[model samples]
Target: MLIHGLLAGSLALSGTPATTAQAKIDCAEVKCLALTFDDGPGKSTAKLLRILKKERAKATFFLTGKYVDQRPALAKRTLAEGHAIGNHTYSHFSLTPRLDDEIFDDIKAGQQAIKKATGLTATMFRPPFGHTDERVLRIADELDLAEVKWTGTTHDWALKDKKKIKAKVLSLAKRDGIILMHDTVPQTVQAMPEVIRELKKRGYHLVTVPQLYSGKLRSGVSYP
Candidate 1:
């Protein structure tokens, strides 16, 4: 995949070794759950990354271009730590309402921002607020991004309470599920330690979105 190739290139540019001792888990044979956080590389994201690292869990982060420009180091560390990154649009705009050229420009700007920040081109995208349509998907496809939607969302952006966020995540947990969250939310970051531990206890392998699909994602396709 283009993203995989970009990952390798980024690693080389950063002087990080591409090979890792981490053993690969085949999701097809195990209960795998993808924990995806969007709209970030925010202040709270560093804490979230620490929690994930302590739990030895890998996740996928959909980064907004504006935030990437603000926290380039955080974005680089995210990919370097073995988590996957995806474009979440340049300005976090709702692509569904925009004109076709505007949609293309926004998504393209996002791709450019990510590339500049981390030297990696993202092949996955999640529309802000989950607002998308066929046209949005087509525009993303032109940028070589697959549309990644969630099986369930914690709605942590609204809840804004750590306990409630944790509870919502537990309730929505499932095998091969892509769970939506926001790393920009402080309460959600606070809730992650407990959430990661509990999900592990439930025997689900916390993995990146691409790992959930075994890295066979196609551009323009919406995922499970």
Candidate 2:
């Protein structure tokens, strides 16, 4: 599966197995997973945060500059509440075929804005559309950032079905995995509480991305 290859090549350096390996980690002491929501700072973003707090969980939010411009306070709120903020580029128009300099500029612009609003500098970048090539990786390396991606998604932005959202999350979830759900969709926010509940029932600890990878605070970017 695409996720298996992606996780093997990108996240783990020491041959960690795929999502099916969750059982061992799930039973491990202090089991953890990274929950990342992207392309956000939308109206639903705050609601998503509320659900996360009720679950007593945290997540990383990759916020686009366009959304930040529209909802600057929401972006600040994300940081204020201790969720890591990441740059999702300014326009999020497209990263494909763009030169390295252009992509870096876009990411930096996003970084500057978020820093301005929240006194936080984001060290994670999600290339638009999950489109990453050698150039994208190089730019992330140059900027001292990590390229963040996801293992499974409900495609909630496309489908509004809450049942499908919860099912997809549970179906593909794994310990220490980065699960992608978007903050722009109400259905996603609606589905997250149950998702967290199920993960808790199954003995998974939801962690920030940096914690998932490095056992550190979510200040810098990281993979898991």
Candidate 3:
């Protein structure tokens, strides 16, 4: 009876959610790099997932609620294939200029959408265009989400050149660096294969955002 009680207590302490028990990569033993994509589950995302699978790489997808509603299967697939899903807002609007209530609603809606589709609530969020302030942070805290930012980016949204995108990511790759890209961009999809290859050649481990910063995620704090 005492052994059973101890086992049940351990389970209770660990939380009853599968999301909480997901395995994480040891970033300390590996040259970890988090490849995070925002504004997606879009047209190019399926192909992006294929590339990631082919490379045996993992990533985090920060999905807009509108798109999650439109492409639920893709969002679900991201979770199915062991990638982390994060909230990128419902409308993908700039949170910096919005009212606190509006920001809170959009963020909450995004979380609800992901939960509805994937059966998992996102513990991470990245504000649209990396914009956020105190109000945004407070609302995120209420939602139990950690605000994530990027350590580097390919600037692929503005640039259509695939080679430049690949080169930029390679140049900026570092230990435990978070590389921001958009899965909605076709050029980004095109650039991802080579970038994955080159990053592997340079001895970097591709991991999700949570895996890259395991045990360090704090609500309301922005991780760069």
lDDT of each: 0.83, 0.70, 0.80
* Stretches of model 1 off by over 4 angstroms after superposition: 1-23
User: For model 1, how does the per-residue alpha-carbon lDDT over 1-224 read when each residue is reduced to its tens digit?
Assistant: 43464333322121111112223567787788888999998999999989877767778999999989999999989988778899999999888999999999988888988999888889899999899999998887888889999999998989999999999999998888999999999999999888887887788877678767877888999887
| Cα RMSD of predicted structure 3 | 7.5
Q: Please report the candidate that would top TM-score against the real structure.
A: 1
For model 2, which pairs clash? none
TM-score of 1: 0.91
Question: How well does model 2 score by local distance difference test?
Answer: 0.70
For model 2, how does the per-residue alpha-carbon lDDT over 11-103 read when each residue is reduced to its tens digit? Answer: 211213222222223324566777788888988998898886566666778899878988889988886655667789888967768877888
What digit string (tens of lDDT, one per residue) describes model 3 on residues 124-172?
8999988888888889999989999899988899987899888888888
Instruction: Give me the overall lDDT of model 3.
Output: 0.80
Better by lDDT, candidate 3 or 1: 1
Best by lDDT: 1
Ranking by TM-score: 1, 3, 2
What's the candidate order when arranged by decreasing lDDT? 1, 3, 2
